[model samples]
Target: MNDHTYKITAQDNILFVDASGPFDFDTMLQYKSETLEAIEKLKHEPWGCIACFHGSGVFSPEAEEELVLLTRERMRKNMAALATVIQDSRQADIQQMQLSRVYESCNTKYHIFSDVKAAKTWLANYLKKQPN
Candidate 1:
């Protein structure tokens, strides 16, 4: 049974994601597939992502490994920035640690935030500064 849930949508150049998780490898694979499809539908220009994570925000080690590859693929697909919002401080910290490793290894730009508004604002500003 799938223990993860996610919604993906795109508005203009920003991809909005709402997800809740204690995800496994299969879930991550599914997410990667759908997310790439969403990215594909965006305008042929640079894009950003805002992901709001709920619940435990935890992933299996294998899932985490898949995330690293996903991050790299997103970067290749012209994802200029990513903002992750997690409400729980502890879960935010764990997610930051894991995602930091993924982003750093992929040389991708990302930030973790506790507020969705702040994340959207930051992503907007980051996208504006990117070369058109």
Candidate 2:
């Protein structure tokens, strides 16, 4: 995976993950690894996350499953909130529903947004509501 595939950052205890187009298994792996590293580096402090999937390419089922599992595991830990941003369409709605199912068995709070700015705002607000 190259630097252009994805970018990860942390601000105000919120982990921001922006994935570029043409997403693939390798890119998914890189994202998962880096996100986990960030969480660990923060000592598993309560945190929120904003994941922007705009322009993402086709991804494998296996990769998607792994990604969901990794996210679920984090939710079991210090994950306080999650915000997802993607295209505003039927396909995006379906994807959001599927993603929501990934957290049905957990207490993870999540919301879907059509834009990154809204998602970030939601994450900030959600994090503020969490117990310190």
Candidate 3:
């Protein structure tokens, strides 16, 4: 991965991924790999995500295409495992535009919320209650 690619840091139970580039194919692939690698960190079970889209709320054409492909890539892996991904929301219009695409590409139902703390709380509770 490029030095400016992205960052992966765990804050308690939250794994924060901050990317420095557009959500292009290579960048999303990096995210996919990091996420898969981070699955081992899901010691809490029923893995969840808090993906925060930074900078402009708009996705470049390349990024849009990569988003679809990356979703498919993630779905393929998720079919053999269990996970629940929740993205930190963006603008209302962007969220509306992107929400359906996310549902279409994901194998299992995923969620989106504008509230980070709320998403994290839900994940924590859900993970805490699941069987080991």
Return the top candidate by lDDT.
1
lDDT of 2 by residue, 1-132 (tens): 433367888876887887654545676777788888887754357898887775543346666676777778777668888898876344565566656766554556888788888888888887778777
Q: Cα deviation in Å at residue 113, candidate 3? A: 2.3
On the 0 to 100 scale, the lDDT of residue 65 in model 2 is: 71
Cα lDDT tens digits for candidate 3, 9-122: 655555555544345556666666777676555434344445554443445566666666655654453322222222433444564366456546555445455556765666
lDDT scores of the candidates, listed in order = 0.87, 0.71, 0.51
Q: At residue 57, give the lDDT of candidate 2.
A: 36
Model 2 misplacement above 4 A: 1-4, 88-91, 105-107
Cα lDDT for residue 126, model 1? Answer: 94
Which model is ahead, 2 or 3, in terms of lDDT? 2
Between which residue pairs do clashes occur in model 1?
none
RMSD of 3: 5.3
Q: Where is model 1 poorest over a 10-residue stretch in terms of lDDT?
A: 87-96
Q: Which number leads on TM-score?
A: 1
Off by over 4 Å in 3: 1-5, 11-14, 19-21, 41-44, 60-92
Better candidate by lDDT, 1 or 3: 1
- State the displacement of the C-alpha of residue 52, model 2, in Å, after optimal TM-score superposition: 0.8
Q: What is the lDDT of candidate 3?
A: 0.51
Error of 1 at 84 (Å): 0.6
* Cα distance off (Å), candidate 2, residue 66: 0.5
Clashing pairs in 2: none
